[model samples]
Target: MADCVCVVSEFRAGNFRRVSFEVASEGRRVADALGLPLYGIAVGSGVSDKAEELGFYGVDKVFVADDAALEHYVAETYVPVMAEIIQGLNPAAILLPASVDGKDLSARLAARLQAGLAQDCTEVVCENGVLKAKRPIFAGKCLAWCEWSQGALPMISCRPNVMDCKAADASRKAAVEKVDAAVPEARSRALSVDLDTSGKVELTEAEIIVSGGRGMKGPENFTILEELARELGAAVGASRAAVDAGWRPHSDQVGQTGKVVNPNLYIAVGISGAIQHLAGMGSSKFIVAVNKDPEAPIFSKADFGVVEDLFNFVPVFTEEVRVLKSTC
Candidate 1:
């Protein structure tokens, strides 16, 4: 039985997602520790070009499943193909991103293989020839360590932004394997994918984020936050309150009830930090809170705070950012 570490390479718009690279790098480390090779699997239509890119991140070999039916992410189609790959490879461990698609695929595959699964892991460690995973529990207030039983295959889904993304090296080389896997007839098919055309960085992948809340008054006022975000080349986010009030879309909401975000810089504009909101973004490297209330809960967790009306402060802040960008 092969004991190599396997990573599933996820792609978006024909390019590798940042999390895919992160998992590849992390999987390399695990493979090295186990004295085994690192393998990558890419699934999609016309994914050969992208599959080759995994070599730059330290993959020794790649298995490419390029088929028209695999173009879009439908669990019904993906799970069966992936199951076949795992059964043949029988890897010691499998790593995937904890994204929406990743979660669905990993869970189904685990059930199929009867493997041990560790979800949303922040750290993966090796001890005495076994894999141990560190994951956040109770809304990130505590960490839990988990390990698979002896000789059991471990399936892990890592949270985004938890590990540092390693730089790609063009000098690295890998052997590409064209795998002709079986695709079963599916009851459902994804005819098309309507992408987010906001022209801004995706929230989970953005290094910098600018967010608004109920204090922004209405949806029209969110334009100022958008302007500031554009100046910083950052993503725009909204608090759950703003989303619940119909001032913003659910996709833009950041909180325990919504999408969790970890960024280098998070600027909260007029947001009163609720526990739920902090649970999502409390892991950011730096936090800046702007609100009129001096005793706002958000200020307690912020590295910097400003007690001023957002209407008066946001315009000036956006102008200063514009001036700063012009100079740089």
Candidate 2:
């Protein structure tokens, strides 16, 4: 009896995250293939006004949960509303961004709905009316293909940057419906939140990344990399060695044991390119590695390699990038 494909939209500062558009674009493809309408579900206090924007990316209709209790992201509050909407619409598949909150929300929703859940999916397709997902497993060592039966509702969390976001069509519009979500008293409430004021783009969503490793000498030297990143409008990343040495936070670490990033351009400064590190960003569209050691393994994978002392090269590189940006 399923008739639609649904997307769970994630928003911050009243703006939809990049993954929202990405998932909606993917959801559009699936809906078209199955001959069903694509719907978007937005949950947050005073978020009804923003739900219609999903239409720009391809959603035909949108469901909104606008309640004070839903102002902040609480799994306890979000799961119930999402479950109610899914049960009402009987969507064949639900797509979510594989963010920290999205991962948590999708898992709990799958359990509550007794549906099959697919996590970290890179690709999604509909074959003969069944939802099939392609996901990376074993820390990107291999990919596994999975399918859901027509009788089962499937919840899928898509990895960031894996799916392309379609350009917004300003002329498109979506019909919105306000859902009455029964939210119970929360056992815990978020009293406050701390914001990252660094102004750097989020690593998972960034199209360009500039990273440093142990060769930068120490934590203080990361300033040069930050300058370069700012000039390039890219995110700053770090290798495990830099993190272990207390030079960078674990949140900035990128590798097999950390976060996986597939940006359009990846610049590795002083990183020796261990197998674990390569496993994380090897899929980058273009790689530029700078290291004084000529035999460093990173060069083998880099589209452009430079052998020079980072201390000497990075400052000059940052200045040149700044100049280039000003000229443009």
Clashes of each: 0, 0
Clashing pairs in 2: none
lDDT score at residue 178, model 1, on the 0-100 scale: 88
lDDT, candidates in the order shown: 0.88, 0.89
| Maximum-lDDT candidate | 2
Per-residue lDDT tens digits of candidate 1, residues 74-188? 8888888888876777688999998878988889988988889999888999876678999887777788999888778899998888776779887886679988998778899
* lDDT of candidate 2 over 1-328, digit per residue (tens): 7789999999776788888999999999988998999999999877888889999999999999888788789888889888898889888788999887898998999999998999979999777777789988776668899887658788899988879888999789888999888987878888766768877688888999999999988999999999899888899999999999999999899998777888999999999999899878887889999999999999999999999999999899888888888899
Give the runs in model 2 whose Cα sits over 4 Å from its true position.
none
lDDT of 1 at 234: 92
Q: Model 1 reaches what TM-score against the true structure?
A: 0.95
lDDT of 1 at 294: 98
